[model samples]
Target: MDTPIRMLENTDEATKQTLENVRKRKEKFDKFERYHNQSIWATIILTSIFLIYLYKTVFTVYSYSFAAMFSAFVNDSNNLTFLVCCVGMYGGMNLLKEKKDKAEKEYHDLRCEIVDRSKDYWKKEDEWKNRHLVFEVMKKQYDINLYHEKK
Candidate 1:
């Protein structure tokens, strides 16, 4: 597929369409990534809240000792509900993470294909490198001329 690099060398209808496809794919990839990150943060925050609540309710009630807190936590039947919720949240987050990874992979694959199809990519890169080298040489010569003129 003709990508942006190819378009730079030669712009046409095909390259335009390819650019559009790249744009759409990028957006989809970004959306999936955002959703995955948000889900993970939500899971972490909710788990933290549950922990805080459990700590306050159990530790305060049963005394500050580790043994007391552990006994209370293990014996409390209602703690099962919190456990289930944590497990469910973690599983859901994993699913979202997987989807995000897939989207990222697809995006990178598309980018690689674009680069491969754009025949002028290496040529353009070489041109830039040559230009930079020429500029550096010119700068050094100018500095030398200035030093000699001052002397």
Candidate 2:
């Protein structure tokens, strides 16, 4: 489900805040990942189109041989501009990938932090509950109230 279920109505505020932060970070990571993939596809499509255009122009006007077409594609001044643009696009895609990686790391770190906090909290709660049970046993067997609060 898209909407989160509130499983624990009495959950501590700190835990709730941590969970909210983790959710936000995960959403950001997902957004970055989507953008990075889109950028990669865009670069691939544009490069393919550019290559097709170059193939038609160079093969028809200059030469039919693969070697000659390759040489013409490399040496042509107008082709240099397209190559530069491709390099620029590649650089931008790399930037998006870097951002996506960073967001992923952040989201994982926050998620782990929340998990650890929950584990620690549950461990302490269990310990306290066990101690409470021991106190009840002592009170019944030894006539001692270990849980008495001092005024």
Candidate 3:
């Protein structure tokens, strides 16, 4: 009777320890998931803004070219205006390109972070699995011991 009582206490303690480990793992995974989602959203927003800027710049350049061609037939004054517009358009395009490059760099960095976090999560999960396996083996041994003693 005393042996059975001690065995029950040990089993309860093991269960408690396992539950605590599972809770910790769940919290860690939740944090990682939130971080990954936020990073992805930020990258998406940045890319969208960059694409919109590129589209606007291209349209402006096209419009300016059309105006410059029409002005060429009208007057010399038109040539100066056309040249200025062309320069402005080119400058705008260059600025947009630089911004796009920066956004891409940020996106790459975020992706690397996500990968690193994912690896960490997997590593932790593996550790938890191994620990659980060990606990199961130990539990089996305990049961076998109890059975033999009873016999």
Q: What is the TM-score of each candidate against the true structure?
A: 0.63, 0.67, 0.34
Which ranking of candidates, highest TM-score first?
Answer: 2, 1, 3
Greater-TM-score candidate between 2 and 3: 2
lDDT of 2 by residue, 89-133 (tens): 899999999999998788777655544454453356655355445
Q: What is the C-alpha lDDT of each candidate?
A: 0.61, 0.65, 0.43
Residues 6-93, model 3: lDDT tens digits: 3432234434343334334334444555555555555556555544544464445456686754454344463455445555555655
Highest TM-score: which candidate? 2
Candidate 1 residue lDDT tens string, 1-151: 3233233433345544654555566667778889888888888987898888897889788885889888889888778788888889899889988888887676566555644565542246565444333323323532111111121
Question: Which candidate ranks first by lDDT, i.e. highest?
Answer: 2
Q: Which stretches of candidate 2 lie over 4 Å from their true place?
A: 1-8, 64-78, 122-151
C-alpha positional error of residue 85 in candidate 3 after TM-score superposition, expressed in Å: 30
List runs of model 3 lying over 4 Å from the truth.
1-11, 63-151
Candidate 1 has which clashing residue pairs, if any?
none
Task: Report, for all candidates in order, the number of backbone clashes.
Answer: 0, 0, 0
In angstroms, give how far residue 122 of model 3 lies from its true place: 28
